[model samples]
Target chain A: MVVNSSAELTDDEVDRIFRALADATRRDIVRRTLAGEASVSELAGAYSMSFAAVQKHVAVLEGAGLVTKRPRGRERVVRGNPDAIRRAQRLLDAYEQIWVARIGRLDALLDDTPPQQ
Target chain B: MVVNSSAELTDDEVDRIFRALADATRRDIVRRTLAGEASVSELAGAYSMSFAAVQKHVAVLEGAGLVTKRPRGRERVVRGNPDAIRRAQRLLDAYEQIWVARIGRLDALLDDTPPQQ
Candidate 1:
């Protein structure tokens, strides 16, 4: 099966995900919701910022697929998406592997391994 | 020993790192440099943007510790730091683990595991 994983996040999706997470409040919101789901009102109460501001942050995260919102009575419950976190993590992992492979090739060239013609 | 790891990144540092990585141009610069080091001028030539634009991107990445710049004769060489990538990855990993642990607790509650007194 062609699994759609964070491993296959597009450049645009990657950009949105990182941008959404650049703020401290947003990161805290994610952490809190990840541990336990909460309504927008609950999240807003935890911050000194306005409810609209917290709602806006949630909107950005929702757009990035970092969190999902579902109707719970009159409130929208927010829950963190582990897959989205995994996706961003996978991108960084890929970059680390790239650096490692480059170093490995350089090490081989300095050793007994023959350089490609 | 007082070892400063990405695992201990402050909120401000996390903010900077994620902000620096939110752009496609910046991400590309990171990927290219990770494969091999390149000077700011060389990077400018590869992109259609002005040299100043590319320089700004490099500066952002440098400030976030995502990349490092060093004097190399008339040019400055830019190289991606794998540790920075690891730091951000670790943060994401922590978030994933938080979600996993929450689910684990929920699963235990449904099973024969006794709830905390």
Candidate 2:
């Protein structure tokens, strides 16, 4: 049998990803980490918020698969997960495609109808 | 001066668009309407929810500029707004670009660093 990948995420997973992305701060964190891997301490230093608050934000992104942590010596490094971002982008593309198809149909309909009533 | 277009949406507008897309049911409604223009009644009939619930969902979409209502005789026709969708997609694209640029910088850094001690 063919195995399903993360692309086949459940409704709940989809909800989590979108919800995680809804917050501006969380989105910023994703961008920062995507630029370079950073330890929790470094991230905490960059933001005005406390270390605990930043940790919580990181936890949310982790939970949503937007970021991943790996042990680097004593500290854990956080990096953005590009695959997850692409997956989310794919969903938006699918939504756009539907709209495009609808517009195409409307154009055809208009062409088919006579000019004057 | 050239007028600022919808592309320069304020933070609140960004929040609304993302929040509107966070719900699966709302996302489904977007997909359905994007596939074809749908009336409030026709949408409600397709879903398991009541007419009020469907109307509320459409209202949320309309408020976010994801969809629009056009008065056609007595009934109001709901059509997905492609420009709004494109605006949202552009935001996502910007996010993706940040990640891509980050990876590029990392690659450059790695290349610059000496491989061995």
Candidate 3:
């Protein structure tokens, strides 16, 4: 099957995903949420920043589709979206793959020709 | 061998790498350089932006260690650094790994527990 994965993220989505991940606090939030879900207040408590700041960070992550917030009674639970993480991973993988392929081609060319000396 | 890979990127490097990747034009430049080295002028020719704007983008990528420039005669050839891309990839992999592990534990818990009536 032709799987449509993070490998297919548009340029805009790539921008959003990378931009969302650009902050240390945001990346940490992602790491925490991936292990388990947390409320915005709970996440805020773990950081030195104000609750409003944490909320804004969550907002950016959510905007990038990196995390999702669901209402649970009185609190909003934030959970990391693994698919989004994988999508970003795939883009980085593409860059790595291109580099690896180029190296392979260069290696092949070196092997095909005799020593220049 | 205890291969220390991109897995070793500090929070600061992660921030820079992702921030550098956040721009579509910068990413395209990375892609171009990965295939083969290109002069800044060559890259600028492909975009509608001014030469100075492209130079600024290249500087960002260089500062992030995503690309490097070396003087080849009068022009500086910009080339993608695969190791840096791998570093960013490893960081993303860590996020994905945590999510997968969480899912694994969830699955195990579901299996261990009896069905709810």
Top candidate when judged by lDDT against the true structure: 1
For all candidates listed, what's the TM-score of chain B alone? 0.91, 0.85, 0.86
Per-residue lDDT tens digits for candidate 1, residues B1-117, read 113563487888989999999999999999999999999999999999999999999999998998999999999999998888888888898899999999999988889767769
Model 1 vs. true fold: TM: 0.91
Window of ten residues with lowest summed lDDT in model 2 chain B: B1-10
Model 3 lDDT per residue over B78-115, tens place: 99988888778778888889999999999999999998
Off by over 4 Å in 2: A1-6, A110-117, B1-6, B110-117
TM-score order of candidates, best first? 1, 3, 2
For candidate 3, the docking band is high
Query: lDDT score of model 1?
Result: 0.90
Question: Candidate 3 — what's its lDDT?
Answer: 0.89
Q: Rate the local accuracy (lDDT) of all candidates.
A: 0.90, 0.81, 0.89
What does the interface RMSD come to for each candidate? 0.7, 1.3, 0.9
User: What TM-scores does chain A show, candidate by candidate in order?
Assistant: 0.90, 0.88, 0.87
After TM-score superposition, the amount by which residue B48's alpha carbon in candidate 1 deviates from its true location, in angstroms, is 0.8
Query: Each candidate's TM vs. the true structure?
Result: 0.91, 0.83, 0.89
Candidate 2: global Cα-lDDT? 0.81
